[model samples]
Target: MKVVFHPDFYQVYTSDPAAAKGRMEAVVKVIDPFAGFVTAEMADHNDVAAVHTEAHIDEVRRQRLYPVAMLAAGGAVQAAQIGLAEPCFALVRPPGHHASADASWGFCYFNNMAVAIASLKNRGRIDSAYVLDIDLHYGDGTVNILGDKSYVTVHNVDAMRRDAYLREVADAMDRCEADIIGISAGFDNHMEDWGGVLSTGDYFEIGKMAAGAARRNSGGCFAVLEGGYNHDVLGQNVLALIQGMAA
Candidate 1:
């Protein structure tokens, strides 16, 4: 897979766990041998503005988070665009599922998933899209920005039991019909992570189901980093999903 990433992503931009040292390194260390790297770019001002208010954009700039935020958002766009041809993963920081149009929390400044999906829609590259957020938390920001859009459907897995969770993902994939599928891939739900629910193999199954759905629809699929705190197992979890998607 062509993983969209940048060395600058290694910078600890905030005090949040998402920005802690070694978070990005953990994933890179393991995936480096299995994936090709693609340099991440900064998002266009218009692209950022498409889903965020100017005030919100200014606020990010005021906090000195504008550059990295834009980079992460742009990386998502790059991953989504590349996904049109093949599956791709974006290793980015400062997770964006918590960011809304005019407000943000949970270490997020810009909603990267929304920005990327909107960019694809704006370009008429996709008629409809499905967002399968496997993160531990709900993607309220993604929902806030895109929930009402007729062309987009965002589903955040919320089952508590491992069996139920995997079933939920399988069910969602079975029902999804779209031109592209995006996974708001977050490893925090891993048994070793904060959420302490899913296993590494579960992530692989989720990724495989997503890829199978996209293939069935003759569409594209991609993923972007969101949350996962355990550096010890984060890399292996990421690699599992990547391997499943590629499979």
Candidate 2:
């Protein structure tokens, strides 16, 4: 498994300067122990006109992204590309599953995963994809963008329920014929996490269960760090997730 990350992602947001830096630093420190598993920085930029309306793109560019959001979105697309090429992980920030087709909200300037999927589909590398969104919040952006497209299937897990969510995941994995899997892994779902409802153990189990489903499907898997505010839980859960995926 190859982990794709960009150190500059820490500095992308000027809104919460300190929080952004802290979150980036914490994720880096936690992942540093898994040396040699990380890959060199690659451009994540892709012109995804299909996913967003031109007006929406212009609005996001004028307001949120300006100069940096583009880079962040680019990194996300690059991570997805790597996943399509082979199994990989994208450690990025300013999590983007909330931005809708017409506007950007919830601190998400661009729908990174959507762009990546669009890129892959356009290149003919991905005939279909299953998006497993584990964020505490619903992946409204992804759902809305790919809602009508049968080639894209979204499985959103609400942090409030564990068994039910996992069962749904299992069902989807068993039924779907997607060529690749994209996980919107959010640590905020962890018990001590900001607005989280699941315990540390539950969080680790969630990752393990999801990874297991991905493995069973014989499809490539790629996960991107979304939102996980509890530092301790985030670190521990991420390490556990890596181990689980390896298993």
lDDT of each: 0.94, 0.67
Reference-based lDDT, residue 119, model 2 = 76
Q: Give the poorly placed runs of model 2, Cα more than 4 Å off.
A: 16-19, 35-46, 201-204
TM-score for all models, in order of appearance? 0.99, 0.85
Cα-lDDT of candidate 2: 0.67
Pairs that collide in candidate 2 are 44-74, 44-75, 44-78, 45-74, 188-228
Clashes within 3 Å, all models in order:
0, 5
Worst 10 residues of 1 by lDDT: 89-98
Tens digits of per-residue lDDT for model 1, 146-170: 9999999999999988999999999
Candidate closest to the true structure, highest TM-score: 1
Candidate 2 backbone clash number: 5
Cα lDDT, model 1, residue 45: 90
Clashing residue pairs found in predicted model 1: none
For candidate 1, the TM-score is: 0.99
